[model samples]
Structure formats: structure tokens, C-alpha cells
Target: MTIRRLPQQVADAIAAGEVVERPASALKELIENALDAGSGRLGIEVRGAGRTLIRVVDDGAGIPAEELELAFQRHATSKVRSLADLEAISSLGFRGEALASLAAVADVECRSRGRRIRLLAGEVVESAAAVPVPGTVLEVRDLFANTPARLRFLKSDATELAACLKVVQAYSLLYPEVRFEYTNEGRVGLRTLGRGDATAAAAAVLGTAVAAELLPVEGEGIRGLTSQPRLHRGSRDSLLLAVNRRPIASRALGYAVEECYLGQLERGRYPIAVLELTVPPGELDVNVHPAKREVRFRDERVVFGRLQRAIRAALNGSQPYRMAEALSSAGSAWRTPQVHSAPAFAGLESVVAEAFPAAPGAEGPLRPLGQVQDAYLVAESGEGIVLVDQHAAHERVLYNRFLAQLRAGAGASQALLLPETVELEPAQTAAASDHRDWLAALGFELEEFGPQTVKLRAAPLATPAARAREALSELLQTLAHSLPQAALANAAASLACHSAVRFGDRLEPVEQRRLLEELEQAEESITCPHGRPTRLLLDWSQLKRHFRRNY
Candidate 1:
């Protein structure tokens, strides 16, 4: 077969396919164009998730009537005039493919006034017989109508709308000086006024709940913030990133964000963040991908390091809820003791004594705080209060025990009274099967029953039967992902939480005292596994201030 040129319309439609994946993508391109045009106020209205109609009105420097047609031509751009301009790309939509691609697959009607023309003179001009306005007004309709395959790939209206909102939120952070309004199906969805502060703009887009949880992130050169540990969500979709005012996604940056909060958050949870990095345009490569999602920095490691520091600083500065204090308060007959001096182990001794008072030369440090609030332990002595997170402590204890048992080949496992069977997804079953030896060493006996089921014959005797099943399943999942040994420590902590007595659970004074004694014996009793302080020291000065007696 002889090679021949493709039809112009077919070629154009194919080009559109590259840049326009869905209605949201189209909206993103238009918004970028408006922003590049120095739009101070943007209004967006969508119908049918931008499939039936999408319109964007911007009050900016308008294009001349003659240049309006040129705007829809491929490679025609006002943003660049020479090859050197590529090195310092300052505009958001410099490629000039957006309007051409959009017009190729949909009906695009645009009207604009020239800088020399009066507003009244250019108010009623027509383009393809479409109505005109003073500033730029772009109307896109019947998107992907000519390409049915594209329509098939599009998600539902609600999903597409969510994608559109995400795009708007990202850009909103980059240009806080521009007021933005979005309307879907004739109902107002979001409105962000020009605030000139990125955090304030983010709050307008992401809502106050997320905004409140976010800690301001500012590095020496880069500026941004990451969300607190408790505010982490299931997906990394909440990351809003902009490089020199251009909204783009970088996998390396995403990984850097995850690495920053590696120890702070649990498995499968991602922190929400909006990061703005300002580097000289010449030091970055923006033309790496067709859609321009990925970017390459001159000093990739430097960028990653900066991101890590910013996120870490933000997390470190934020206040975390003290779970151990809550547990101690819930326990009956527990009192916070005062510290008169700063001894080497004053605080630890006080914590142990309060948690577990000595009975005239008690043996082996009062049996170590076992479990308080069903998750932590309280031990008190003369120095202060020692609040221990049972889960973290148990994790450390059990990890060493499990490792020793594995090496000794004499690990003990207690037979279950009744065999327990757990059903998992095929992937989970595969993950569990791969880590059978590790499970055995951890004191879990398991055998595959069917395609997606496992039968458990025994579990660690130290762990409660009620919590064994959940712990086994969690361990299997963790092992499947090849998580580090540190993850097992976290799992152990979770297990301790499940088996320990919980807050609001009525406990006799003796039981509470016994739990406190156990905490005193445990090492690292100052905090829980998650790094929350186990005990809070309210000083005499603070107490006086609370009662207004200091004056």
C-alpha cells in the first residue's frame, strides 16, 4: 500500500485526541489560555460535564478581531517568537495547540476585541455567526462528538465534574490574584476571590476542614505546606502542585512527598499538600511529555531534598492530639504528679509510680505497664508520669521476641480453640502465600484452603483471640506489599490497641493500677508508637495561671 497524507479533518481530530482526553481536559486547556492572557476574573459554566457545552468568560487583554481566527491555527502563538524563548517559558499555555485541538473535535465560538478597538465598537462582531462580547468569550460545544471512541473513554458526568474541580483548584493556587467562579448545571459550585495568598486561595478551593489540617510549608527557596498526619487520605489525588505558576504533575515530586511523611502516616494513606516551587525556568524541562505532566529539573536531587524538608518542617510544627493523656484521664484513680527537679529519670519514675505504685520493694519493676485505655499504659513515680503507648511498646517487645524466636527455632504458638478461616481477594491470597515462613515466625499458622481463602490453626499466645484474626489479616496484607520490618512494629502496636482495655471501659482501681505497673516496667514509656506524648506535664505555674492566682 502506498503512503498518503491523512485527511485534514481526520488529522486535526487525531491531534485533538492527544490533548483532549475528556471534558475536564478541555476545560483545563481553556482556563490555562485565559490565565495566560492575563485574565483577572474568570467565569466558567459547564453543562453535561462540558460534553454538551462549556463556556469561559475572562476579562483580559482581548485579541484583535483578525487574530481571533489565527488563535485556532496550530503552532500559532503570541507567547513565543523564537527558539530561545522555549528555555524561559513563563506563560501557562504557550504550545498554541489548545484552541486548534479543541476546535477540531468540537464547535468553538470565540469573540474578542482588539486593544485599539473601543468596547462598544467591537461588542457585536460575529465569528462563524456566533454572538460576540467585548472581552474574550470562548464557547465549546459537542466535544468529542466527531470522535465517538473518545466519548466511550470518558467517565461519568459526576466523575468528570470532580476532575474539572481538581484542575480549577490547582490553578487557583498558582494565581491567587485572579478571582475564579465555577458553575455546573446552572448551580454555583465554587467561587474564589482574589486573595494574593496561596494558603487563603487553597482554603477557598479545598474547604476549611482540609485547610485547617494543613500546616504552612515554606523552605528557603520553595514555598508550600503539607497536611497533618491525621488528615491523610486514601489517595494522593489531593496533591496540588505548581512549578513557576504552571500546574503540572511530577511523579518524582509525589514520591518525595510520600517519603517526607513515611514514618508519620500509616500504610495506604497519603498526605494532602499544595506545593509551589520557584526555580529559574532555564533549569527545568517542561517538554518532557506529550501532555506536559512530567518535568525534569536541572538538579533533581536538590528539588526532592527541598520538598522533603518543607513537608517535614510543616508536620513537625503542627500540634498532634495526645492519645495517651486521654487514656490516662479515662482510667479511674489516676493522678498527675508534680516534678520538683529535672533528674535523669525523674519524669520516668514519676510516670511509673503514678501508673503502678510500689508495694514495699516490688519485684521486677512492677510488671511493666501492659495496656492502658485498651491501647496505652500509665506508670508513675516521684519524678513525673510515664505514659506508654502499649501498641508501640508491644511492637518493639514482640518484634525482638519474634526475631529471637525465629533464630532459636523454638517459637511458641498456641493452638486455637476453633479453627478460623479468612477470605481474601486473589491478590491478597497471593501476598499471604508468599510470606508463609514470615507468618510462622510471627506465631501465625496458616494454610491455603482455596483460591482466595486461608485457614488459621494457631496464633501467638500473647495476643488475644478476639484480635488474632484481624492481626493475621493485616500482617498478610503488609507482607504482600513487601513493607519493611518497621511496618510489623506498627502492626504490633495496632494489635496492642485492640487487645488493651479502651477508654470509656469501666475498670476497677486494682486493674488500672496493675496496667500502670506494667507501663512502668516497659522501656520507652514516654510516648506511644505513633510518637504522641504519653503524659502531659502541667506545671504549678500553669496551674496557677488557670486559676487566675498568678497575678
Candidate 2:
């Protein structure tokens, strides 16, 4: 086969695909252009998750009448005119491909100054006069309309809308000086004051209650907000990182931040952080990707070390964490598993047989000897020695109970003596509003107290009152991204995880015994809801082999 040049239309479509993978990507490009144009205030509106329309109005320098048509031409740019200009680019959009690429696949209308131009599939369809305005108003309608296959790949309205909101949230945090008003389907979802206050911006995006718990992080050239050790999320989605006010994805840098919280957070938990680093433009390359959401640094090690030290210093200066109190408070609602046993172990053999049906003639039930390190239960079983992760076992037990309650629609709720108010992040608020009925079925009695704020009058029976906020936050994080098919299971798991007994919680002898009895009867006791092993077995033969005493 011989290689031939591709058609211009095909090439344009391919280029547009690279730049505008989704509605969110298109919005990102437009917002960056607006920011680079020195827009102090931005108004963003979207309909049908940006599939029907995306309107952006900014108060910035308007385009000249003659340049209006040129703006839609490929490779046309005002930010870069020379090799030197391209080498150390600081502007968010300098490639000059945003407008052209967007126009290739969608109908675009641009109005700025005293000029107006409209394009259909990258071809001029209309060019007429419009009302003079100081800034620009760009309306993108029928996105991916020309590319039928691309339009079919878009996600559901809720997921796509969440992605759009996420893009806005990132910019809001990065540019606190620029006020942002985001409207979705004619409803204002988020608004931030542009007074240049980072905390206030964070509150608008991450919710006031969450922002209040963040500790200030200040270093030589790094600054932002970070959560306390006790305040963590189920995923790293909330770990917002930017370089020189440009939001980019860097897993290495994210890991460097997480490294500072080693041992402080649980294995699967990560801190909620908004860290911005000021780096010299000459030392970074932002042209790696078509969307420019990724960048390469000249000295990754230096950045990593500085980031770790700065965040670590901030965490060190915060108030001391009370481990015992926290553990106790988290387990305040935990009750000993109600398992009936015959007097003097009369029917223990049947329980053992049920637990290990494969091991015939197995010794009776396990005898809870004691706890090791206050985290694991050491029990003597017929197989030999068994070490149980106390927390994981309890989590397994509660997961089964919560899942059953969710399925049966009979979840027992524990009412709080006094209603407590909680605020969630904007994205979380959207998720909560959509899944309010499901949350209620999971035993969360919530009332809308304010925007992104809810009053918790009751919680799941297993969830302690002190941990109501944490439980809701974890569930919301899971629900925000989980698919419809898996939402209920994930919510049940989140509820179980928050309500279960925590590691390091000292258990009394009776409690430990009751826990073992419950585990013996659990539907699935080998692993917890998150797939972590709940118990480990050490057979007598292996122990004898290790000791070299095979008799």
C-alpha cells in the first residue's frame, strides 16, 4: 500500500477530535482563551451538557473587525508570532487552534467589538454587523453535530454536566481574582467572589465547611489549602494541583503530596488539597498535549522535594491529632454482634462446620485468645492460628447489613438529638440532589438547609453521630462518579466503611468473642466490601514446618 496525503476536511476533523474530545474540553479551551484575554469576570452557560449550546461572555479585549474572520483560520494566533514567543509561552492558549478546531465540528458564533462572524463546519456562512460591546460573547451550538460518530460517544447528561462543572471548579480555584458565574441548564450552579481571596474561592468550590477545616500551606514558592490529617477523601479526585495557575495533571506531583500524609491517612484515603506552584515559564514545557492539560518539568525532583517539605511543614504546624478519641468516637455507635451460642460450647461444632464445610471433623468454634496491637484478633481455630483484621471483619459484617437494608428498604435510622448542618462541594451537591431518594433509602435523613448545604437530622443506625459529616462526605464522593448500576452497592459500602469499627480501637474480651462469632456466620467473611482480606489463616502444618518440628 502506498501512503497518500489525507483530505483537508478529514485532517481538520482529526485535529478537532484531538482538541475537543468532549464538551468539557471545548469549554476548557474557551475559558483559557477568555482568561488569557485579561477577562476579570466570566459568565458561562451551558444547555444539554453543552451538546445543545455553550455560551461564554467575558469582559476582555474585543477582537478587531478585520481580525474577526482571521480568528477562525487554522494556525492564526495573536499570542505567538515568533520562535522566541513560542519557546517561553506563559499564556493559557497560544497554539491558536482553539477557535479553528472548535469551528471545524460545530456551529460557532463570535461577537466582539463592532464585528460579528458565524461559521458552519469551519466555512464562513454569515458575517454581519452586531451591537458593539466591550468584551466578546461566543456561543457554540450543536457541538459535534457534523461528526455523528463523535456525538454518539458522549456520556449521559448527568456525567457530562459534572465534567463541565469540574472544569469550572478548577479554574475558580486557580483564578480567585477572576469572578466566575456558572449556569447549567438555566440554573446557576456556582458563583465565586473575585476578591482574590483563596479561601473564599475554595469555599465556593469545596464548600464553606470543608474549606474551614483546611490548613494554610505556604512555602517559598508554593501556596494553597490542604486538609487536616483526619479529613481525607475516598479518592484523589479532590487533590487539585496546578502549575503557574495552569491546571495540569501530574501523577508524580500528586504522589509527592500524598507522601507527606503517609501513616496519617488510611491505605485507600487521600487528602483534599488545592496546591498551586509558581514555576518559571522557561523551565516548563506545556506543548506536550493538544489540550495542554499536561506539562513536563525540567527538574521534577526539585519540585517534588519542595512540595513535600512545604506540605509537611504545614501539616506539622496544625493541631495534634487525637487518635484514641477519634477511634472511640468513630466506634461510638458500634454494638457487639448479636450471635447466640449454646451454653458451654454445645453447638459450636455446627457453627464451625458451617464456616468451613470443606474441613470435615474440624474442631469446634474459634476461641478468641486476645488482640495483638489492638488492631488484630488472635484466635485459635481448628485449622491452626487465625489472625483477624478487626476493622475489616467489622466492615464486612456492616456491609452485609447495610446492603440488606438498602435492598429491603427498611434501613433503621438513628436520630440526632439536635440537627446538624453540613455543606458539600458543588459537584457533590449536584450528586446529592440527584440521589436524595437513594440516600434516604440508605438511612440518611437530610433537609436542604441552603445551597450546597444540608441539615442532617438522622443517619444510619450504625453510623455514630460524631461521624455523620464524614459518612455523608464519603458517600457523596462515591455517588458523584459511580454508575447507575453500581450506585447502590457503592453507597452501601461507603456507609459500611464509615460506620464500622476502626483499627486501633481496643476491644474488650466479650466484644472480641462476639466479633468472631459474627464473622463465623457472615455470608462472606473472607474479604471486606472493598476486597481487602478480613482474616489470615496459619495452619498447624505450616507452623510446624517453619519451626522444623514435623513430628
Candidate 3:
């Protein structure tokens, strides 16, 4: 093949593919332009999942009449003037490729300042005077019409709509001061009040119930919303981070938030957070991605430290967490208890020493009023009532304490009356020998009796002797497939599980109160080591709904 220069149209199409993959990509570029134009009110409307029409209206500075046609030309930007400007790029959309790329594949109509520019395949079909608005009303129709291959790659309407709304919702958080209205299929999907209130914006997007549980995070160069550890999602989709008003995806950025919640959120569960960071223009780079959704920072360590401290500080004095009760069982009979007519809580000495930083029930926030099925503890809280899972809650309390001990030193061990000899399969025996040090750290005193047998001499602290053999055997089996750190954690969780009191165990009123009190003291008492929630909060409204007490 001979070396040859690609035609301009072919080159433009290739460049367009990088910037405009779908309706959502085009929407993102336009939104960035609106924000950069100093738009205070952004209205976005879409139909057919943005394939038919993607319109964006912003109440910002309109483009000058003379510059209307040039705006669609490649690399023509008012954002940067010199080499120094490019190095310190601040605006969200700067490469000047968005409008050109969009026009390459779609029918674009741009009307601003009494001028009109109609484009198709990156060509100017018409340029004339027209009625103008105060800001920009840029509409893109027949998206990917000429680019049939790109159209084939798009997902269904529902999926694409969700992706587009995700981008809009992210901006809504970054700029709570800017009111936004999103309409899809001739109906309003999301609208946010531009009052600079992140909490209010959260309610609009995440619902009022979740917003009520969110805490305000503030720090140097950042402020946003973060939920309690108990209120978490199965995935990190709910976590949003924006740098300088640009929604970005950086594993390190999300990790910083997760690190602060290490002890609170168990494995596989992620917290919901909206962190907006503002760095000096020179310290951050947003040009790495064509979509402007990923950024690089000069000081990631500084950002990580600041964000972690901000979240922890925000959590200070925020009265612990209580799980929200759901209608899980079909017919679990319960009563609507009166609210807040008694003492909040009474203190108690934790039976398990050094189990938690604060005594769980010391403040008597939720008084243990009674029990249900000898397994669930019913409590009278300040708001309404609380349902505590006796077994799962106890597991959480012990798990955190046990994990902390294992990290501090070799865990405290309780000696057994007589050593129990356990027989393992060949694979399990090999795994046990490989993880022998880890087993010891988990407070297991074991010796290989044979190629397929081992003796369990002592159980980890808090684990009863009766279940010691079972716990050790489970640990060895887990060791076969787990990484070093994960295997240790699994072993600790196994020990905690075997030691926790059973669900059917009968508890006297005094014992119930004691358990509730200790729960309040654990570092993060939301979920057990195995990720099972310990308590369920039945707020006043739920009680009213069931009692038919609606006014």
C-alpha cells in the first residue's frame, strides 16, 4: 500500500466517531458548551432516546453573529488563545471538536444572535439571519443518520435514555446553583431547583427518603453529599464525582471515598456519594478523554487525603445508622408502637470488653421494649420503633471487634478442654498448610497430624469451643480459593459467625438491652461481617400505613 493522505470527509468522520458515539455523547458536548457559556438555567429535551432530536437551551451568552459559521469549524475555539492557555485549560469543552464532530454525522441547527447555521456532514448548507434568543438553542436531529455504522452500535431507547440522564444528573450535582429541566418523550423526567443546595438536588434524583439519610461533606476545595454506611448500593453506580464541574470517571477518585468507608460498608457493598472537587486550573487536566468524563490530577495523594478527611469530619456527631425496614415477609404481624414518650436510652457495660469504641446502648437511643419470635428485638426509638435482628446484629458487633484484634496482634484465643482432630480432603490439607500462618493469626492453634488431618487446639476469641471445629474447617475450605488478604478476612468472618448467638436463642429483657447497648458502640454496626443488616427502622409513616391511621 502507498502512503496517502486521507480525504477530509473521511478524516472528519473518524474524528466524529471518537467524540459522538451515541445520543448521550452529543448531549454531553452540548451541555459542556452551555455551562462554559455561563448558563445559569439549562433545559434539555430529548425524543426517541435522543436519536430523533437532542435539544439543549441555555440562558447564557449567545454567540456573536459574525462568529456563528466559524463556530462549527474544527479547532476554532474562544477558550484558548495561546500555548499557555492550552496548558491551563479550564473550560469543559475546548478542543473545538464537539460542534464539528456533531455536525459531521447529524443535522445540526444553531440559532443565536439573529443568525442561523444549518450543517450536514460537516458542511454549511445555509448561513443566514434569523430570530435570536437570549442564549443558545442548539438542536441536533437525525443523529448518526449519515453514519449508519454508528447507529447500529447504539443500545435500545430505555438504556440510552438512562445513560444520557446519568450525565445530566451528574451535572445537576456539580452545579446545584444552576437549575436544570430534562424532558424525555414529551414528559418531564428530572427537574432540579437551582438554589445551590446539594441535598435538595439529591431528593429530586434519588428520592426524598434517601436524601433524608444523606450527610453533608465539606472540605478544602470540595463540598457534596455522602450517605451513611448503612445506606448503600449493590454497585458503585450511585457514586458520582465531578472535578471542576465535569463529571469524571477515575478509579482512584472513587477509591478515596470507599477508603473512608472501609469499616462501615462490608465487602461487595458500596456507599452512595456525590463529591464535587474544585482544583486550581493548573493542577488538573481534563483533556485526556474525548467525552470529558475522566481527568488526571497533579496531586492525587492530596485529593485523596482531603476527600477522606472531609467525609470523616462530616460524619462526626452524626448519630449512628439504623436500617430502613422493608416489607420483606408477606405477613409478619407487628404493632404500631407509640413514639418518644419515654427516656431515649439508658447506659450499660458491654459484656464483651473492648468490643467497640462507644457503648452501643449507653445513650439508650432505642430502648429495648420487647422481642418477637425470640429472635427479633422490638425497641421504642425517638422517631417510632426499631426492629433489631438478634443474631445478625450480634455478628456485626463481634466481627468488627474480631477484625480489629486480628489486625492489632494475634487475636486473643480461648483454649479448648480437649483438642479436636479434624480430617480434611487432600486439597483442604494442602491449603491449610499454605495458610498456616494466617490460621494462627486468626487465633487458631493448629498442628498437621497427617497429610489429610489437623488438630484444632484453640478457637479464636469470642468463638465458643463447641463450634471451633466447624469454624476451623470452614476457614480451611475457604483458604483453597482465596487470596492471602481475603483468606484472612474470610477466616475472621467464619470465626465470628460460629461465635455469634443463634437466632432462636431466648433472651431475657436484661440480655436484650445489653445486646442493643453494645451494638450502639461498635465502630460500624450497620451490617454483619457477611453483609447481613442487623437492624430495621420502622419509621412513623410505615406504622401509620399499616395501622390505617392516615389522616
lDDT of 3: 0.78
lDDT of candidate 3 at residue 475, scale 0 to 100: 69
TM-score of candidate 3 to 2 decimals: 0.83
Model 1 lDDT per residue over 1-551, tens place? 99999987788788877888898889989898898888899999999988998999998887877777677788789998898998998887778788888878887777677322211111223444334555688888888887888888889888888788777767777788999988889997777888687667767776554465568888956787677654556677777777887777888888889877654555666777778888888999887854677678999899888878887787666554321111121111111122243333445344333232122122224333344556545554333334444444444344445545555545667889998999887666876766566567667888778878888889877667877788777766655565564545544454444444445455555765654555445444433444343443333343344445767
Ranking by TM-score: 3, 1, 2
Candidate whose TM-score is highest = 3
- In order, what lDDT does every prediction score? 0.66, 0.81, 0.78
Candidate 3 lDDT, 20-132, residue by residue in tens: 99898999999989999999999999998999999999998989999988999999888988878867777888888999999999999998888989999999999898987
Question: Candidate 3, residue 361: CA error in Å?
Answer: 4.0
Residues 1-551 of candidate 2 have per-residue lDDT tens digits of: 99999987778989999999999999998999899989999999999899999999999997888999999899999998998886778899888899999999999999998889999899989999999997899999999999999999999998888889889999998899999999998999889999999988888887664566678999967999888765666778878899889998999999999878753555677788889998888888888988888999999989888899899899877652311011111210111112243243335343322221112113248899999898999888777767788998898888888888878877788899998988889888998999877788778999999987999999988898899889998899999988886788788888888988888889999999998888878764555777555765556654555555778
